[model samples]
Target chain A: MSSLIVASIYQQVINDVIHNIQRDFEDSGVDVSVLNELQQLWETKIIQSRVTNFPPEDDKNQLEQEEDMENSSKRGTNKQKAKARSKSYNQNLSVGNINQDESEDELSDANSVVSNKYPENETKFTGQSAASLASIINTSNTNNMSANTGYPLSPSQRKNNAFEEDYDDQNSSTDDESQNQPLSTRAPQFLASGVNAPLASMSPMMGQRNLDQAQQNSSKINDLLNNNATGNDYMYQSLGSNSLANNNSQDTKKPYLPQNDGCDDPISVWKIFLAERKLKQLNSANKLDSTEQNKDFNMTISQVDGDNSENGGDITEHMVLCQYDKVSRTKNKWKCVLKDGIMLVNGRNYLFHKANGDFEW
Target chain B: MSQYYELYRTSTLGFALTDSLDELIQAGHITPQLAIRVLMQYDKSIAEALTNHVKARATIKGSLKTYRFCDDVWTFIISNPNFKFENEVVSADKVKIVACNARRPDEA
Candidate 1:
């Protein structure tokens, strides 16, 4: 009776942990597709470890019985659905050995739980992918079984041994009564079992690390989708589809263009203000054609450039230095001014894009 | 104060959100989980606002409550999408390497 209670509790805890992990991934912006991959990876690890760790035939038989009963009941509705399918479809769906219905059913149970949890946006595992994943899991499990039965442990299996040690430490410290019981009385040890005890305490750290990795992977995928966007260039790619679409149409309407004249030379604020004023005036006049306005705009920018060339260089330099000093003083920091009209950020000079207020370096 | 706190103070929106959080913390309603969620929400809002060209003050309604923040300077702040609230100031080359989805000059 005590053993049955312990087993039930363990199963409940596993379900809770799986649910929590799903929630954690969802909150971290991991979509259904990636979540599916993560779940598969975790389940694979659990199965592989179980194959190696559980040696006694009695324990294996009991576990298989429990898993079979649970999976069949869960898949009870699906069995009828499967009956209507053609033999070829059933063969395709049954990726594992036909005799090992219990394990296959257990695998499907895990997959179905994830799908059922997110009915609205779940990414279901297709037959082909599920088959391939099952095959991979089987091969890994066989390797683990061989390592346990015949040869010394592989490096990864050694890690699993370490995990078992940690699990023993945790289990012994927490449940002294359970420690006295025979190992065969316990439930089949899976990868998640060892990790679950530490999960509550370590979840924040683990979740954060996993979230960071997932975010990086997704960002890389996004970049690849965007024609291998190079260096601050992906920003423009994503922004172009939305807010910039309007700007693009406006650009087509107006023949006026902003040109990058020199890398070092900074456009005076006054020049931009003057240009804005002239453009506004020309827009209001409604008499000048686009080509004409474009000509006027270019002439105005060049004329401002020419006029500034006389004293604009020195004055702008002085103004930038003063602004830099003001910022530095406010922040209680000292920074060296550089040759280019760059803004000092964290005590370093970086070229500033006045139009969008970005670093141009 | 973290670098993000400093950066937030530079704008009205950042100030408003920070102030609101301060008020919540003082009120004893803010947990660590809540704080992290709020921070993530703030970052997402900034990114979304930048993409949508919301160049004015906007109100964001989170799961907890609604708060208003200035977005006028978001275009400048969002020049790098790789920025997170937890990130420190990186070098210019690293910044340049961050793919910017900012509107092109033609589009702008």
Candidate 2:
């Protein structure tokens, strides 16, 4: 009785899907025979899995007819009727699967077009910055030369020119320094440049021979330089601490080395370090190889486990898919009202309209 | 639009249909999009057929090992479960129950 019900439920599902997707198949320009083939393949697979005993072929036709009547009775809703009409109209002008590929290609082309704009915009932005920097430098140089030759420039004007030159120097030095340090180390340099900008402007005031102001500015510059030095020291300290941790680990492992044989010679110590590094590399490589082999072994085991049952595995096999009408629990006892469920138990499939489950946790 | 849950796709029947659809796709007899539409139809049809056609009722008793309620889905792992139908009783060492809410998402 259970097998028969399951078989009939499966039959109904397959028939309903096939009937519903006829328009989709037509629109896709796939031959109707392919859909028939899919149906046959699906049925054969289900039978092979032996989830349930299907009725004889003659009985199948009777079951299908009965299901068809039931479906027809329930499928008279206006929404589906409207959908059917629309599908019929679309069938006349359906462009088929070829158009689908073309549409995908067009979508990719659009994405590529959008992606191509990004690099061009980045280049334009960089070019504008470079041009503006060059202009600033040129104007400052011309103004300084004109002031020196024609007349004495005001302190503020000299200060502005000095600040510009300092900024240009910082920019060029930073570009060069960037090549030697990681990006994280550049943060302190930017802070240093920001602190130096105002002090750099004051340097020209010292050149004007205001003795007291010159001394004050020099002291301020010294303090700023000290602060900049501390910032750099902190950055370097973080990097050094990381390296120190690594060295400590290496030192702990160093006892394994032959300490009695030429341990005092610098060359011997360097050679030992090189050999240890090579051994570590080889060990890591071997570990990676073993991990890969383990992965392959696991894959084979899982594949064998999957082959043990055609229904994927025990997890998928002994499972239930259902809707819960009501689920309530009190203390350790649990109860549920499950409806419209498909239960795969002990390699056999069962269909139930409603299931009452009482369990203790 | 009424949408059906894809929870049943892990069932043997749905798995077989998906395997066959995959084969059709691999053979270039049908596109992936068409296969997806077929699956969508399958979801709707199966949900409807199970609700309207089958009338079998079952009573199950077990010791629940683990129970979880997440995202409106109730999952229960039961040990030594016994399922009793009209005249037949099926027993399994362990069974997993994955139950979605009866009320549709849109309805909720």
Candidate 3:
């Protein structure tokens, strides 16, 4: 029976380990399957433990006791807060239970880690802000639906969603594993700190050329109306095809990249990729200059990271929304990668990068 | 105790990585350091006597696809027909992560 108990013990450990690995690698590409065989061993142990009713360890209660002791100091008003957080967390976990294997209690404990009601005021992995982590972690099914979100979701909807997620991330339960290093944050927020670093100093007019081209070629409204009357359907179709083909070619250039190890470290790999991208941007800009085209507004470095504030460092009291040079200004769409290679998106700027806004419109 | 190594030793039993375990650990069901340590040791990057940890970006989901490179961080696509990845620094986030399939038949 001791062998059975040992089997159960190892299985439990492996199962839990794989579960965490999945969470780490879920949305990102850190293929954690390198450790998957261990999961079967764990599942077996769990089944054995259940059939035999073997109790391997009770250390969980000891930790809970310590947690209670820690929270005892603020027992007066935090009871409600704790209850609400734990309750919602439990609900989320129960929902997860429909798809997972953990016991209800175990899953609830885990959900609290990503729920809006934990004590994640102290972050682990990397000491990023609650607001950022809230968006990054526990967002498994976020894009399961198409981003073309049937009806436009208002900015308030986005903010409210972001706010709830931030709450969960900030107050997430502080597990031992989470207490390690902080998550990766791309490039130290190269622009947010207002460092004036060259890596973050590309001009924003970099993107305007394409917009200007689109607008310039957008045949006058009267001409378009006349063309609509005279032109054949084939012409419009061919134009549409040409536009899509151009965009596809730009997207498919397959810029050079260093082989990346895992899926979860977008920030790290992106920074490394961007380092090479800087040279390409310079080359492209030079070519444009030679042709005497797009010289007016054609440089922009808009990096983003955990350190970024609303806009570099110069926030205006009377708000002037810095408009982005969009590939297409159609609403509810976000295309950071444009026909002119990758470009900036409005919302957040990193380090001290600013958009040198020059519009031909 | 050394989960990855033990599996490596067998090298016979079919192995498929599960995403549920990653969720559990992120949610605090298990320890990340210890778990990753055990996983890495199985990757043969660790010595039995060495208990210390070495960090590297493991797997990532990017805008286009969800993929994980080998230990050297070499490129390997995890789609329908698993193939060696060409060199490039690809981001890991902003992609939809699907569950990994079974390991190659010749891995043993």
Q: Point to the candidate with the largest lDDT.
A: 2
- DockQ of every predicted complex: 0.04, 0.25, 0.01
Residue by residue across A256-336, what tens digits does model 2's lDDT show?
A: 111223343332232232233233323323333455345334334544544322122223236888999999999999999
Which prediction has the highest TM-score against the true structure? Answer: 2
Query: Model 3, stretches more than 4 Å misplaced?
Result: A3-52, A55-59, A63-361, B1-17, B20-108
What value does the interface RMSD of model 3 take?
25.4
For model 1, the TM-score of its B chain against the native B chain is 0.39
Ranking by lDDT: 2, 1, 3
Evaluate fnat for each of the predicted models and list the values in order: 0.00, 0.64, 0.00
Q: What's the TM-score of each model vs. the native?
A: 0.17, 0.47, 0.20
Clashes of each: 8, 0, 69
Instruction: Give the per-residue lDDT digits (tens) of candidate 3, residues A1-361.
Output: 2222322233333444445456544333222322232342233223322222224223322322343365433321222333343344343321211122212222222233223322221121111112233234314311111110000101111111222233333344422222342331212111112222231223232222222222321432211111111111111222233322122112212221222234343222222222333333344334333422221112112112211211221111111111122222134222221110011112110110111211111
lDDT of 1 by residue, A137-255 (tens): 33323211211111000111122221232233322221243234323111211222332222223222321221232232233122111111110111122223332212221222222
In candidate 2, how many Å is residue A304 off?
A: 29
Clashing pairs in 2: none
